[model samples]
Target: MFTGIVEEIGTVEAVEPGTDANGVVTDARLRVRGPLVTSDARPGDSIAVSGVCLTVTDLPGDGTFTADVMPETLRRTALGELGTGGRVNLERALAVGGRYGGHVVQGHVDGVGTVLSRTPGPRWDEVEIGLDPALARYVAEKGSITVSGVSLTVTRVGDDSFGVSLIPTTLAVTTLGSLAPGARVNLEVDVLAKYTERLLATAGSAGTAR
Candidate 1:
């Protein structure tokens, strides 16, 4: 599991085809090349690459690592479209004693969202994203949402969209600063909300049957 806290901004070095014959799955070699993240990384360790939980397949020296992207993961997340030199948010798995700086995140992208607008103010910027209809119910005002592996609070929510405010520190340290309107981003809604909704739905059905 992850905490949706971005540690570094990594770059894609290479992308090769995986064992899948349909050209759907891919193997990505990323170059974060940072000591704090790569020093103890081993095969099968989970790392959040731009909000997607990818297992390390190989750890090449010089700060580089490799992970395989499955076909379903490619279709459900935004990692499949990455090209060489593309920048991505990176975070290692949260340790047992690590501070919970952000909300709980699975590093699993539920779906992809598109940037709808960016309103810049004197001290902060408000980013709005159009989310998928199926995931819309999980978003709420003041709720937590992970976008591109960065945990952010939902400033506002609409029928099919949500907004997040970004401070200067967030802009400087993560890949969100470079996002423009219409750009695609990986989105993971709060897991608690999803579970709550399921329980409520089941209870409502049970009540109606009585």
Candidate 2:
């Protein structure tokens, strides 16, 4: 589990694809440079890479680590789109007794969202993300949403989009600082809301059956 808190902005050193003799992609490996997050890293540790939870397969030292990316993960999230020198938000698994700064984040990207617009303010920037109508119901004004591993509050919500205000610190310390219109981001809505929705649906089904 994670808290949607970004610990560092890591650089993708390499993305290697394991191809078979037939030139079919069998698997993929990613090398990321993260000084702070890799300080105590080891193999088998869980890390959130741009809101996708990946297991550490190798720690090659020099403040770098490698993780294996599955094909399904690639199809579901944006990790497959990364290239060498790309920037990614990195965070270690939320440890017991650690500070709970952000909202509950499983590091499971539910879907991809597109940056619709960005409005720069005197002290902050408001970013609007084009949402999938199915996921928009879980998001509310002032609620929390995890975008590419950074936890932020939803400032506004529409039928097909939502907005978040980014302070100077957020803009400087994470990949969101460089986000522009039409950028793709991994989005994880509140897990609690999803659970509630499921329970309500189950209850309604039961009532109808009776």
Candidate 3:
């Protein structure tokens, strides 16, 4: 589990495509350079790379670690588009008794969203991100959403999009500041909303059976 707080901006060192016996690419291995995150890292540690939870497969002792990305993960998130020299938001797994800076984040990219527009303010930037209509029900105004591994509050919510305010600190620290219109980002809606929906559905089904 994670808290959706980005600890560092890591660089992709290499991406090795994994192929099958038939030479069909099925997965990818990514080596990312994050000095802070890799300092105490060991093989099998879970790290959130751009909102995607990946297990550390190897540590090369060079401030870099490797993880494998499955084909389904590539199809569902924007990590597949990442290449060498790409910047990615990185976060180590939440430690026991750690400060909960952000909301509960499973590091599971629910879906991919596109940056619709950016409205700059004197103090911050209000960014509108296009969302899938099916996922709209899970999002609410003033609720929390994780975008590219950074947790942010939804300032406004629409049927097909939502807005978030990025402060100067966020703009300076994470990769979100460089996002352009039409840029793809991994989005994870509030997990609490999903859990509530599931519980309500289960209760309704039980009432129906009675």
Candidate 4:
């Protein structure tokens, strides 16, 4: 599990697409340079690469680590659009008894969202992002949401979009500060909300059957 706390901004070193004998793309391998995350990273450690939990496959000992991205991950996330030299938010898995800075984050991207607008304030920027209809129910005003590995609170929510306020620290530290309108980002809603929904649905079904 992850805490949606971005440790550092890593650059994509390389992207190698895997193709089968029939020339069909099967998967992609990524080499990312994150000095802090790789400081103690082992071959089997889990790392969150821009909100996607990827297993560390190799450590080239040059502050770079490799992870294989399956086809399903590419189809569900913005990672497929990443190219060499692209900057991505990176975080190591939460250690036991560590300070819980952000909310519960699974490092699992639920869907991709687009930047719709950005309203700049003197101290912070209010950014609105388009949300998928299926995931809309999980978002609530003041609720927590993870956008490209940065945990942020929902300031305002609409039927098709949600807004978040990014402070100066967030703007200077993570990839969200550089996002422009129409840019795509990986999104993960609060997992507690999902579990609550599931429990409520099961209860309703039981009542109906009784």
Clash totals, every prediction: 1, 0, 0, 0
81-152, model 4: which lDDT tens digit per residue? 999999999999999999899999998899999999999999999999998988989999999999999999
What tens-digit string does per-residue lDDT give for candidate 2 at 1-210?
999889999999999987879998767899999999999988999999999999999887899999999988887788888999999999999989999999999988888999999999998998999978998999989899999999999999999899999999999999999999999999999999999999999999999999
lDDT of each: 0.87, 0.93, 0.95, 0.96
Task: Tally clashes: model 4.
Answer: 0
- TM-score, one value per model: 0.92, 0.96, 0.98, 0.98
TM-score of 1: 0.92
* Alpha-carbon runs more than 4 Å astray in model 3: none
Off by over 4 Å in 4: none
Candidate 1's displacement at residue 103, Å, is 0.4
Error of 1 at 8 (Å): 0.6
> Using alpha carbons, what is the TM-score of model 4?
0.98
Q: In lDDT terms, how accurate is model 4?
A: 0.96
Q: At residue 122, what lDDT does model 3 achieve?
A: 100
